[model samples]
Target: MEEYKIRIVKTIQYIDSHIDADLSLEKVSEVSAYSPFHFHRIFKLVTGETLQSYIIRKKIEKSALHLAVHKNMEIKDIYWDLGFSNHSVFCKTFKKYYGLAPTEFRRSAPEKFHKILQIQSKNGQVDTVFSQYICNIENLLNWTKMNLKIEVKEMPEMNLASVMSLGIANVEPSFNLLIDWAKKKSLFPRENVKMISVYHDSCKITPLDKVRIHACMLLDERLSKQEGEVFPETIDGGKYIVGSGEVTLDDFEQCWVSMFLWMNENNYSTRRTFPYEIYHTNFKEHPEGKMIVDFCIPVH
Candidate 1:
């Protein structure tokens, strides 16, 4: 898994740097040190998207933001600069992905795309943190980087309905079991119920097959303890450094490392508590390309 993750990081860096060039799977596999045939398999397992699909989406997505925010440039110039080769191709792809022509999208959604670019830029700070730690030839060759910043804030304690699952590493299974358990116990009230997951072990340090996960749902005034062997633990909510981003399974290590660095830099500490995840989006609702999970950690 470590080798796979390393290769995945290399692939992302290669695409990021060569966004203007003709980036093909064959070329990417060569750059990432993988066999051409196995490249797609590993890419899918790690990032949940094909290399071509991800690159195209990212290019369109970023170019959309550039067009939306940069009013000084003509829409045709932005399309040409994005390597679309022709106006018709650019317009077709842009409208297919964003549901509007370049001009229409720029006029109607500049503010929305601007905020996305801001968040994405903030998220790219992981590369800066990596430069502080690693110094090696592979680091140069791979350019593995993550960029993210988090802020600290306080939250009040909330009740939760939780069910411990034996399949700890599989997050989807854990959440499914928790929801089913809640349903069986008739404790899934509609109001004020928020889904949460606690990360008890570091995936980078722990084996991916055995990492621990806890699935939970916030309780409201109407919720009461159900009859079963289910356990409820208090999550002492106080000051917490909140970190949120969409990351692939392979990039989980970089995400945690960045968060730890952010916490230490900000002088936040905790004696004993597992950081929790508020799964704001699911894979079924959004394409795997856009799924996001927000991570929250309590601190002193």
Candidate 2:
């Protein structure tokens, strides 16, 4: 299983590096050294996305980033450069995925753009906003009652035991499984265990069912082989913008949206590491019935 995961990672990296090149199944499967039929199944199993869907999402995301950062570039040029065949096709696909045409998205404020992307589309139209307060910086500040403070801090490296879940809302089950395994092993004093969830894909661009969620527990070293779905890995240390707040499950999406808006407003670009959530409270039994979490995004 670990070998399969590594092969998928290499294929993902290859696709990313050659995003503008032909990424057909035959070519990608060849890169992974798997038979095309087996590669398709394993790719979807490991990454929670079919190979074609992954490629399309990456192309669209790259185009969106170009649209966000290169203000003066023509939308048609941007889409074509990212491998879209034509302007009309790009516009149609962008609207289908982001709920707004490229031109409208480009004109929107950063916060508004982010909010639009977060909206779940229904029948080819964006039906609502993720949160009313996600429209602008002033609204976000007002909604948080001026208490949404973000600080940039240097964090040390971490070794973690992790379990992966495919859907955003399905993460709790994975966390529960990890915790059960931890208890059986007597891995730590309950009071000292640190709970975290690492996000490996953007909800805005990736389908909800295909988003990668890693429920993790901080550990000093790798655990010996144990049953169930948990795996061990290391996270590199870096500078991160940490935003702490008392929030409910409903507030999770907006919290990260607000942090991203803040980063864009402050001209702080993100590093390649996945963003994560660190729980500081027993989320299931919090006195306020809200999770106390630190939203950490690696940034430069």
- Using TM-score, give the best candidate's number: 2
Instruction: Write down the TM-score of every candidate.
Output: 0.46, 0.54
Give lDDT: candidate 2, residue 135: 33
Model number with the top lDDT = 2
User: Mind giving the per-residue lDDT tens digits that candidate 2 earns over 1-300?
Assistant: 134334555676688779999899999989987656446654554455678888888788777767776789988788877888888889888888889988887776273344434444442323332122123324445555454568889987888899999997788899888888888889744676799989888775578988998999998786665466988867778999988888887777567756765565566878889888888877569766687788998999
How badly does each model clash, as a count of residue pairs?
Answer: 6, 0
Q: Cα lDDT of all candidates, in order?
A: 0.64, 0.73
Give per-residue CA lDDT, model 1, range 115-198, as digits (tens).
653433344534642332233323422422333446777877767666665345566776677777778767664554578877
TM-score of 2: 0.54
Instruction: Single out the weakest 10-residue window by summed lDDT for candidate 1.
Output: 132-141
Summing lDDT over every window of 10 consecutive residues in candidate 2, give the lowest-scoring window: 125-134
